[model samples]
Target: MKKRFWIAIPIMAFGLGWPLLAQENPTEPQPQHAQAQAQPAVSAPDVKSPGTPQLDAADLEAWLDGYMSGALEQGDVAGAVVSVVKDGRPLFAKGYGYRDVASKLPMDAAQTLVRIGSTSKLFTWTAVMQLVEQGKLDLDADVNTYLDFTIPERDGGPVTMNDLMTHRGGFEEGLKEILITDPAKFITTEKYLKDHMRPRIFPVGKVPAYSNYGTALAGYIVERLSGEPFDDYIERHILGPLHMERSTFRQPLPEKFQDNVSLGYMSASQPPQAFEMITSAPAGSMSATADDMANFMIAHLQQGRFGDARILKAETARLMYQPSAPHEPGFTTMAHGFFSGPINGKRLIGHGGDTIWFHTDMNLIPEEGVGFFVSFNSRGKNEAVYGMRERFVEGFMDRYFPDKGNEPLPPAIQSAQADAQALAGKYRSSRRIDTAFLKLIYTLQQSTVIANEDGTISFASEPGTKYRETAPGMWRDPNSEGALHVSTVDGQLTITNSKNPVSDMQRVPLAESAGLNSFILFGSIAVILLALVAWPLSWWCRRLYGQTLGLTGRDLVAYRLSRLLMVGDMIYLLGWYMALQPLFQMQFDGFGTALDPLLFTLQAGALVPLIGVGVGLWNAWLTVRSDRHVMAKAGSVLFAAALCGVAWVAFIGGLMSFTLEY
Candidate 1:
């Protein structure tokens, strides 16, 4: 969970927006081939309600029973907990599915506790705002003022409290041990932040990268200022006052509650997993029951008052909901750690979280005075939890607050084709790592915009859902509140969407395109492999017929050296892949200190490619100058060029770096 929350690398940070890799969908959004929409796919509800349906305990339960029962079973979700509050009252709270499938123990909303991943950040943000209200912290002041350590400045400026809350810290994603199996290796919040102070990739408050480290930093600051451990302060101030007895930020949970925590599973049929240990605790470490979560949600909906308790002043609670100034027109913005999305013609403020087997979403409709929280124990097939939750949100909105959408026929605009053509390209999410090998995630996750023949744009992130140019540079999803606003920021095209306010997609320039990078990497490796394999195969064939060698003297020496260098390049790549590949493959349970020495050795291997480039150039020059066959000369030149590609890919991808932070 710390992976985005590494604090979960996904916005889905909490994929928690990762393990910022798991997602609201509880799985990375893989790029899929799609057909251009003659009509847009269902991104939201289409049923036009004649009038608002009455929402009460009985109807709400009936609605949930009708929808969730089939959804959980059809999706293969093991179990779930759902809690909803209206007018500061829990209108509905229930648990569906088994808490323990092996024992067939049914889930209980008040008894079963689930880890509420990145949604835990709301408490950290609330803690910061509490200090702000007391004049103990400055939102605009440098965060360094409150900490013992320092954060280096970049594009945005000195990191500020406001910046962390808005998730604009721009720290590069790093560290693999988001969820460690061993409790003995757990690190303190302060220690984790100090050690993993991810390099600032964006200027102060420039881009929102959904930082778990940044949020954890705020929690550390709260610990420092409040003169208490983060967990203790939370227990004394927030949880105690809200009467959320079932909630606790303690890792592994307190012994008393351990038995009550529901087991997590990748699938219902799979074995239950160990407790996910998030050392960066404050970022996404909280377990609570549906009843307790409902109470916490009610506090936010009622301006921080729960029963007789007050966690925040009414104004402070109100302040927390203020959306950041819009960077793109109609694009929802992150506000004080809340994903302030304007859905169904009303502002919904909340956050979503994922921790491998468990996925959850907590949202509050401030204007409507209602809050909804849901959690699924299993990711289910194809991360179908995303669709289930989406269906719930849209269905609820349609029943309670329907939006009178436009006519079915897409509007005809003369410039739609031009706009579509111009916008057609790949865009990388700002949440990706800029200074480490984790940036490789960008290659697979980069969102592509394909221009459809019908003058619409198909966003790869929302496959099969065509977005028409609703305005000049803005495209609206016909089915949902999702909007993609394309604008030029410092001459670079930035695509900001309403669905994910925490991160935006910047147009991937040709030099940085994943397609180009992959081509260079694979094509170069293939060139080296060809020569390496042919050298011995040619000798074997010659010996079979007892043929005499054609080349002699300097040609023989240069050719031998070229083949040797190619072997070195291959060895260099293989060693590095062995060292770093697991970090990519294992997102949920990251590797520990065992990889340090191996990584150091791999760093030393960077020299092999450097030397190969020089030797390859000489080989190319000798063969081109000599009377070698045309194919041989071409192969030599290609070999040289392959070494050059390796060097370029290594430099830009940070594979050659000595730093082992990630």
Candidate 2:
């Protein structure tokens, strides 16, 4: 669901007999000349003839080989395997580079077992669709009926299967909060639903927020209805039927196939870490070879038939290719699993996958009966894979609709220095109240630019430690993309694209500011301490102050602590607000700045009662403390809570040092 640059053939053109249109003439094309330009028209060639105008076999091989080699040269990949199939026949299948760089082992086509990432979701969806075809599940039925746990509804209506498939289930983005931390714990669809039964972020069946949890839930539904494990069901129903013997939910690299496996490598900044299998297998924990993937693509292109065997009915496959939801403009359609889009007017369905150490792409042109799969074992920002797909599609289109040759490159337009400077002014979005600073930062340590770019930028922080820009105005320190934005306005810098106008961009001297450090250190320590102590204090407060507080000591403690914590949180929030305020008129409220330490301390204090209640309750249950020994119980709780809070705060503070701005 994370949007990436996509390259696929058109579905409408490929399906239902839509005539292919030639690429727009480059000499007289559209106004936008930011990136790629359109190609010129070519005459169509006869498809029935065996010999036609297409990339020569030798040239095609060289192109693919050059692509793989270039990827390695650019340090975007350590090794890779590529496979091209046309008309259900293997045009070429080969591997390039080393599988084990340290051991100096060569990679082979048959042995690669790379983490295919979210592409695994396609297989999961395929299995679910197969079940749908079997009359085992209904897309419109309430998913909660099959779930073992309650799925909280939005507006008192349970989410349906269709919502899950289309990612319109109204579930919050649960990956960072739930999945990444401990996926297995939330494995059961029922448990996941129960834990996340809050109101929808957007109306169901409206906006689509890509959710791995939603797809994982669908996988679970398959398991429950099929009476088989999610992985086994796919293997038996889909993979097995397609004769994809090497593909598996588990690591596909066995000893026999180890020789051919490509060694996945991260950039030197992000050295290869030991691979840990994700417990959320359905979302992105599977491995397969180019040979196996080619077969799968071929089956889809052939209307769900592999040779004489029909893996899925043609009508069902057609439904899978139908547009299920509206995507951002330029995107063809987001079908059940595949993305339906255009490539020179030819319909194409495909998906791309990016994991820790791999990038993959698969595209199929059903009308031309051609498909290709390419995977890289390293990660970088070069758009070669996408470019390769475009070229391949161009070749295909030229063969089928020869009149549509490669589009001419757009005329280069150099922005005048004065104009460029004029456009350099700080600009901010009018949608939000946050401001992201985008300027060059010169510190005693190093000089760096925070300039906002259209695409990703990487920072080499330390050896094997890299930061990648995951979103506009935001960079991911290590792996996952964090939500952050930056904008420019009249040469002034603002952080988030807040609606509020920012003052002037005043440079802050980078030094050890006590207030900033305290906010960083104490704010974190207090939050952790409070979080640790709040619950326990709630219980003890229920017993001690419950009668006096007009509620259980626990309830009173929870309520009071929550309120105070909320206040402290508000102070910090206000400080951030002031920091983003317009410079000229900005006034850091004395009260807000002054209360920083107090708020921190109060946050720590609130934890005391909470911890006291926890220890008291635990000790009382275990008979470790007598009723007369309330003070001792409270002390014990305080000690334990303080230790946990300190430890947690330390960890969080370390993380903040790399991520947060003072």
The parts of candidate 2 lying over 4 Å away from their true place are 1-57, 176-199, 251-261, 268-271, 327-330, 380-662
Clash tally for model 2: 56
For each candidate, what is the lDDT? 0.75, 0.49
Candidate 1 structure quality by residue, lDDT tens digits, 268-288: 777788788776788888998
> CA RMSD for every model?
8.5, 18.1
Per-residue lDDT value at 366 in model 1? 76
TM-score per prediction, in order, is 0.89, 0.54
lDDT at 232 for candidate 1?
96
Expressed as tens digits, the lDDT of each residue in 1-662 for candidate 2 is 11122321110000000000112223421212111112111223325445454644565676666655665656544566667666555566677766566765555555455666667777888887888899988888898888887665566366887777666676543321122223233234444444444335445665444555676788888889999977778888877766676677753234554444455565422345344244446766667777678778767776777765667898998898787764433345567766666554456677666544555667777766677777666543343434433344454445544433334322212432222233232221111111111011111112122322432322222223222333333333332111123344233343321111111122222332223333444554464456556756766877886543343555445445544443444344344334334222212122223334533443344344344334434533432333435754454454344333333332322211221111
